[model samples]
Target: MVNPLDHPLFARVSHYINLINFLVLVPTGFLIHFPYTGAPINLVRNLHFIFMYSFLINGFVRFYWSLFSKHKDLVSGFLWNKHDLKTFWPQIKYYLFIGKQPNNPNKYNPLQKTAYLSFPVLALLQAATGFILYKPEKFGGVVSALGGMSAVRGMHYLIMIIFLAIISVHVYLVFTEATEMFWLMFFGKTEHKKGI
Candidate 1:
């Protein structure tokens, strides 16, 4: 039997774009927020904005793919449901090496589905606060609504750090899995883990 992940245009392409976007945006954003004097502040700020725009555009593409991709196998696959949350603990145990993997769900495990769905929500929070913080005067209403600039800045920084932490764990998990996992993301072919 063929692996369901054999298709080139499946999960890999969108993930590649997302990883690249985050790789560029996250560093530039961090530098801009806590700038080093090595480069002109204006230059860093410009770079941050450039990457920020790219991040938003990339988000749009991801959203489009989630909703309309031709591979309809699990287009909304990441959206969480009750069963996902209920079965989340076993997956956690599996990850921690105390239990077995879920009984080979269609694509993502329950935990995977919940975790994957959250990034876009985080992106929206980051972008909204980023816009208000970018120009407090222009978005004065937003600034006040968010309980002033300090709160907006706080939330923006918080999300950045949280994503960084999540990405760290994500990378570790990906590499710890079989080599096929890496190729799955790059070439869209995962030699199925028997009973995965």
Candidate 2:
């Protein structure tokens, strides 16, 4: 039998590229902001720009592929609906140990959809603020439009903290509630078994 977890090739490629993007950004971001311990700001800035372009290209490619590809269901899964909202409370209760697993066999659990939905918006904010701070002259329009460099910096920092928190929770949930799902993301190729 074909593995239900066997995702489309584009999805797999997108996932791998996304992982690479994260790896590249994390260190680059650290070095760019924190010049402590003799870190070279110039080198970090270069690496950050390189990775940022890679990320942008990957994202654009994925967007184009999704628009034209047959596996549109995967993309549609991220969209929120009334049912997702209705199930949100139950999903929370289940995660918090106050209720049982939800009965629906959704493409994405309500909570999962909610989290995934925030990623694109947060990523855009991170990139937009980074660009404004990186070249205040070129992005002076954006910086001035946002009130100034300091405001952009503050927003960037706030978004970074929020991103980190979301990542932490995502990691925890992957190991705790979705260990099997996590495995499927990497090696497993079986359809998601119900009633787990």
Candidate 3:
């Protein structure tokens, strides 16, 4: 049987890469933010840039896959409709332990789609801010538009905190509410209930 939760190999691989990139970027980014006297600051910055590029590339691949792959319908969850708006409250209540889960048979519910869709925008903001910090001369116009270096730095740090919060909630839900999803993301397929 064709498992609805089964991801294509390319999708799974991109996800893995993105996960690893996130795992590396967060710590290295922190280290860069709060540098110590003995810390290898250059190394941390290098790793941060490397993984940041990997994350961006992986995001582009996922975007391309969404556009060209056979699973366009599945990837198009980022585009929502009136039904999604109607179900949003129910989904929120379910996550908050106040109501039953929404009975959607697709891979991602409206809430999940909403959360997943925000990542790319967050990533782009992170990338732009990072590049501005990395090469202030190159992004002088952007920095000025964003209210100078200090403001850009603040925005970048704030965005990172947002990423942390979202990732924490996502991980919690995956482990507690959808353990199979964790496996499915890594292995590309999962044995789960009909709705997944």
Candidate 4:
């Protein structure tokens, strides 16, 4: 069977969506980190709110499609397994220059699996905190549960930083390891190879 990663179009779409999310959400999220001062603050705040809702909706649709669509296996591969944990250290070593390559080249590397697992958790934290901060009155229960507006805001800021760091590493790895694969995400084509 052909590996799905070899499909350029799929890779391109994945890369494109991630880039879109980063471009639209990151800057506005950063601005929301600081205290607002003027009319521009209102504009930024509006954009932030709009993007947050957009992201939430986009994420839900993606999740639903992944779970129920034909590509469910792709999503399943991202889930943690004992084998992933076993290879985690070797994968780290490979990335750190101690090893030439990972022992197993499944759909995703151990690091990728770990990162994928964390993405949803971090996104949830960000969304939860963002909602709490967005409407301290309406979401007052959540805000209080999270220890007030200040605490929720602080967590939201921290999660944003973490999200950015993950994106930076993800982008770097995508470019360095497989530029062609990255291009596939946008163009949606993959090179053909003979049976294994």
- Estimate candidate 3's alpha-carbon lDDT, on a 0 to 1 scale: 0.83
lDDT by candidate, in order shown: 0.73, 0.76, 0.83, 0.70
Q: What is the lDDT of residue 87 in candidate 4?
A: 86
Q: Which candidate would rank higher by lDDT, 1 or 2?
A: 2
Q: How well is each residue in 18-70 modelled by candidate 3, as lDDT tens digits?
A: 87998999899889989989999999999999999999988888887788778
Among these predicted structures, which one has the highest lDDT?
3
lDDT by residue (81-185, candidate 1, tens digit) is: 666776789889998899987774546677666666778789889988888887788998878888888898899989988888878878887778656667566
Give the lDDT ranking, best first: 3, 2, 1, 4
Off by over 4 Å in 4: 1-15, 35-39, 190-196
TM-score for each predicted model, relative to the true structure: 0.82, 0.83, 0.88, 0.82
In TM-score terms, candidate 3 sits at 0.88
Q: Give the local distance difference test score of model 2.
A: 0.76
At residue 66, candidate 3 shows an lDDT of 84
Model 1: which residue pairs collide?
none
Tens-digit lDDT track of model 2 for 18-105: 7887787887887777777877788888888888788777777776766777776545667777777788899999989999888656
All candidates: CA RMSD (Å): 4.3, 4.3, 3.7, 4.6
